[model samples]
Target: MNITFLDSSTLHHKNDLDLSPLKQFGDLTLYETSSIEEIATRIADAEIVITNKAVLNKELIEGAKNLKLILSAATGVNQIDLEAAKAHDITVCNVAGYSTPSVAQHAFTFLLNFATSIPKLDSEKQQWPQSPIFTRLDYPAFDLQGKTLGIIGLGAIGKEVAKIAQAFGMNVQALNSSASSAPSGEIPRVNLEALLKTSDVISLHCPLTEETKHLINRESLSMMKSTAFLINTGRGPLINEPDLAEALDKGIIAGAGLDVLSVEPPAEDNPLIHSQHPNLFITPHTAWATIEARHRLLDGLVENIKNYLAGCPSNQVV
Candidate 1:
């Protein structure tokens, strides 16, 4: 029952990860590799493979004949070859809901910054006395109270965002990709078109799936009010980056706050990187890396591994 964690750097580098439970299971080997070519040889004798960024494709899965399970430290398993793993009878598990609070807080941070023009004001203070603009109260900030906040996902994180929005005196509404059997109190469910047209601030917290990919695109952007703000704390591909850039250029929306991009470590030529728009704020994909959230993720990951060892896999994926 040997277990190896490939790309454990994402967790081990964080101060919060508790490796005690993982050590109790079996021999735990960890590595940080930039090359996928090295995976087969590295995982040859491992029965369980835990990966955060390492790609477990068909070739690597085939080569690791002893591998029984793959426990992804993150929620998304897009990097893994699910079909090949299923063919090899390898169980795959992913930790979910571990970063609900962390992500939700980030979404609100963006919303508040957009609503109040916090960054703009902070920058103004630096050049205040030297410039003539310091004498005038030219920059105005808006309050979030009585504003409509639209959420694209109604999952745990979305629900948390809604609760916090309500605490801020905002009117919270949501649009679920599919209809839910359970009722959402206070937060009324609305259609995409309605939410886009009416919301003062819109936030995304959905998973990236076939139907949800580029859910916010050119056509949808056109429907939003010019003063509305868009926030994405979800998957990068969920919104078309180019379309968002055009929207910002044309003033289709007031601004955008994105924690995810179409690509991780976005290229130098990325439109969002050099956009002249002062309203656009882009953060390196770190909405889930808060100290508290990483601890929860580690705890859940250990539980997943422990459950798998007990022959009753938790968080099992097809």
Candidate 2:
């Protein structure tokens, strides 16, 4: 069987992560990246295709006559056309929960940065040599203990984050719109308005949908405590970039730490990119790309393929 990975670079560069295990399945063709113009041609004769961020729309799916299976190397399959794949009898599978630990850890990395004023302290390290006292209190750090953490989503990563927060003696709450299956737990559910007003730190783990798009906007920011901090390791579009930049500028909120943006590799003109607010922290969507997580994602894809070939077809979304 012919197998192709359209965007292998999303998982690795410079042969850092192994893809050789896939060689046992079929003839594998790897592309560092594929353009919209090149997708159809590359998958023309492949039976199985794996993509991380490469888009596979209706037209491309219809044209690839030999395409039998599609494996989304990451959890989100938003780039794949589910309806088209189903109509064409192409089995679609996506890896999930593989990056839970990595993402949850990264979210706290941001939270701790704000809580401990690590960035500010590091920036002011040069002034330490001339200090009149033993230690510089230029930026005082706050304790996470007793501070409420309002989580916008209560999925695997969100749950893990809650566990960590509790370990730090934080009180945890989830948004009312969070996962419906949020079971009996230490975390209580609160409405958006309440979460906004009460939380000392708000961390977003929600998916991006019409209801959640721009969920954090002018009105919501206005409701939040002036000292509250926002952390988003989920989807970027969940918060309005311009609104967030304005909030940071006006001190409507204390700060924001973001791992994803509405647009990946955000345009040079993105408001948040240019905000330059000392409190604004942005990581290039790497919250879920740890070496360990990437390996789990790759392993999940191989297992899905192995199952499909065995006629079991695990993790099939369609």
Candidate 3:
């Protein structure tokens, strides 16, 4: 098989990950990155295509005359044209649950930073050395104990977050996306309206869909506690960026710790980019890039291809 990795830079490092497993499959061509115009030409004759964040659009998919399989190097498949793949009878596979722990931990990393004002304390290191008093209560810090944690989506990552919140003595609640039935007894499911109005802390873990896009907007922000904090480790479009910026500026909610944004490498005019809001913390969409998780993703990709070659496919998007 002649396989082409359209954008391997996402999985590449300076002599870090072992590539023997991927190379053994076929004559592999790995491009660190690719241009949209170049993608059609580079993958023209490939039997298999691998992509991390490259857009395998309808035109590109149609141009790959020899294409058979497409293995997405990550969980999200929005970058690929699934309808085109289905029409062409090409099998598409993605790795899932590979970044559960990494993402779950990152949510708290941001949450704790806001909850404890770690950044401000570090910035004022000189104050600690001074002996004006035994303690410097300069910020509004609070304990996680007895606080409410409302999770928007209760999937694997969400469940793990709920467990950690409980360990911190927090009262956990969740909003069922499907609303099919209640989840396990530990975290009682609540409606979006109730979760918005009641929880002291709200974290988003849902996917980006028409209904879920801008899930947190002016109206929803209005329902939150004046001092509550918001955390997001899921899809960026789940919240409207402009509304969030306005919310933070006017103190609509307390603050927001975001690991994802509606736009990556946002433009200069992006509302959240230049805001000096002390409460807004934005990480460059790296909540899922831990070393352990990346390796799991690599291993899972090889396994997905192995299954496809054996005449069976797993993790097919329904």
Candidate 4:
């Protein structure tokens, strides 16, 4: 079997990952990165194609004459055209639950940074010695205890984040997208309006869909408390960048911490990138790139292919 990895560099950053396990399957061809134009020609004669964040549209999928299986290196499959893969009878599978812990921890990393004002404290450390008191109290900090955390999605990652929030003496709640039945549990589901109005901090973990795209726009931002903070570790399109930038500028909400953007390698003129808000923190979509998480991702990919060869594919998306 011929296996081709279209964008190994996305996962094997700094040559840290070992790709030897993939050798057992067949002749594997690994490309550190593949451009949009290079994908079709590179996978033309391969039986299996693996990609992370590569745009495999209908044209590219149909062009690969020998392609049998498509493996998404990450959990999300938005980059691949599922309708095309299904029409051509190509099997598509993705790795899931591999980055739950890493992403959950990162969400809190942002919340804690905001609550404790860590960056401001570090920047003013030089002035600490001049104070005659035991310690300088120049920056205002808030305790996470007693604060309410509203989560948009209650999947594995959201559940983990809820556990951490409870450990900090904070109340946790999730948005009830489907109101068919009233939820009754530790993390009770509430309507979006209620969540936005009551939560002191909001973290988004839901997948992006037609209904969820730009879910947090001007109207939603206006509903939030003036002192509330926002955190996003899921898909970026969930929030409207222009609206968010304007919100921060006008103090519509307290601040925002984002790990993902509407577009990766965002344009230089992106509103969020140029926002003058001091409370905004943006990480380069690295919440899921921890060393341990990457290893688990790689292991999951290998297991997916192995199962496919055994005639029982795991995590099949199409």
Candidate 5:
């Protein structure tokens, strides 16, 4: 079998994450990046195609005559045309739970920055050292010990984050999207409105769908406490960028710490990208880019390939 990874650099960089595990497979062709115009030709001879972030549209899916299995290097399959793949009998698998620890850790990495105001304090290097006062209390820092953490999504990542929040002596509650599947005893499930109204911190771990897009807009922002903070490490479109920017500027909420934006490599005019608000902090969408997480993703990818070859498909989305 000829397996092609359209974007290989994302999975393995240098010797950090090796591709030797995949050598057991017949043959592999790797491309660091592929343009929209180059996808069809590059995947033309591939029996199995693997990609991260590259769009596998219906036309490209149809154009690949030998393509049998399509593996998404990430959990989300938004880039692939699932309907078209189903029409052509192509098996699609995505690795999930690979980023649970990474994402959970990153959520706090952002939250802690906000709670401690580390960046703000660190930026005042000269002022802090030259000050007459031994202790620099110029900027305020909050504690996470007794705060309420409301998680919007209750999947693997959200659940992991809840555990960490509990360890910090914080109260963890989740928005109950499923009444029948509410978490037992530990994390109380609340309604969306209630979660928005009462929580000290709100984190989004939900998928971006038509209903969830712009979920944290003006109305929802108004519902949160003025001192509350927002964290998004999930899909970008889950929050309204412009509204979030305005909210930060107007002090609607204390701050926002995001690992995603409404757009990737956001346009220069993107409100969030240009905000530069004292409280808003953003990381370049790397909540799941940890080396250990990448290894797990590769392991799942290999398992999917091996299972498919054995006439048993694993992690099938379609």
Candidate 6:
């Protein structure tokens, strides 16, 4: 019953995780590296592999003869090869809903920054001493009240965001992934095109999938209001970065605030890095890494490992 955590550094560096429960089940080994090449060696003799960013493909999975469980610390399992794990009889589980609050809060933070032009105002205030007093009055901010908030993928996190938006007097609407299971109640579900055309502030909260990848592109950007702002806290590939940069340059929309990008630690050549607009806000993908959320994720991962050893695994993906 060997349990090895590859890339434990992601969780270890944040909070003090109680590994007492995990230790009770089996021998535990923790590693810091997330590289595929590194993980292949570290997980060689382990029965259960706990990972946050390490990629477990067929090549790596086949090498781990004793591996029986794959416990992903986070919700997204895109880094793991699910089909291969299923074929190998490896139980794959992921922690979900743990980051709902953290991610939802981050989405609103971006929305507020765009709605109020907080960054531009903050920058201007720093230079106020050199400017005329009249310049201060030029940058008026808008209120969130009466604005239409369009949400894409009204899942738990999106619903939470809608509830908060309602508190600020915002009219909320959503675009559902499937037409039949449309989100009901106060947040009426609308089509993608309609959401883009009518929303004053569009926020993305959907998972990244084949159908959802590049959901926001040049054509969709063109449908948005010139004054509308786009906020994405869901996944990076959900929006096309190049198309978004072009839109920002041409003023296709008012601006954008992205917490996720097509590439993590985006390349220096990325357009968003050098966009010529004061309206764009780019944050390192920290929307789901809040302390509270990380704790929940850790708890879930340990529970999954315990359950797997107990012969009744919870959160099993395969």
Runs in model 6 lying further than 4 Å from the true structure: 14-21, 129-135, 177-184
Candidate 4 differs from the real structure by a C-alpha RMSD in angstroms, to one decimal, of 1.4
**TM-score-superior candidate, 1 or 2:** 2
List CA RMSD, all candidates.
2.3, 1.7, 1.7, 1.4, 1.7, 2.3
- The true-structure Cα RMSD of candidate 5 reads 1.7
Please give the lDDT score at residue 54 for candidate 1: 88
10 residues in a row with least lDDT, candidate 1: 176-185
Give residue 92's lDDT in candidate 2 (0 to 100): 98
Error of 3 at 225 (Å): 0.4
lDDT string for model 4 (1-318, tens) is: 899999999998778989889989999999988999899899999999999988899999999988889999999898899999999999999999999999999999999999999987898888888999987677689999999999998999999999999999999888996533444666788899999999999999999999999999999999999999999999999999999999999999999999999989899989999887878999999999999999999999999999999999999999
Off by over 4 Å in 3: 177-184
Segments in model 5 whose C-alpha atoms lie over 4 Å from true places: 177-184
Deviation in Å, model 4, residue 94 alpha carbon: 0.4
The Cα error of candidate 1 at residue 204, in Å, is 0.8
Q: Candidate 2 at residue 3, lDDT?
A: 99
Q: Model 6 reaches what TM-score against the true structure?
A: 0.93
Report lDDT per candidate: 0.87, 0.93, 0.88, 0.93, 0.90, 0.86
Segments in model 1 whose C-alpha atoms lie over 4 Å from true places = 14-20, 130-136, 176-184
Candidate 3: how many backbone clashes? 0
Q: Over the stretch 1-318, how does candidate 2's per-residue lDDT look in tens digits?
A: 899999999998788899999998989999999999999999999999999999999999999999999999988899999999999999999998999999999999999999888888888788899999999887888999999999998889999999999999999999985434446865788889989999999999999999999999999999999999999999989999999999999999999999999999899999999887888999999999889999998899899999999999988898
Candidate 1 residues 227-312, lDDT tens each?
99999999899999999999999999999999999888898989888998988998998889987888888888889988888889
- When 2 and 5 are scored with lDDT, the better candidate is 2
| TM-scores, each model vs. reference | 0.93, 0.97, 0.95, 0.96, 0.96, 0.93
- Per-residue lDDT of candidate 3, residues 1-318 (tens digit): 898988887885774777668887889898988988889999999998889888999999998999999999999898899999999999999999999999999998887897899898888888887858887788768899999999998899999999999999999999964444564666788888889989999999988889999999999999999888999999889999899989999998989998888887677898888889888898888899888998999898889878888888888762
Clashing pairs in 5: none
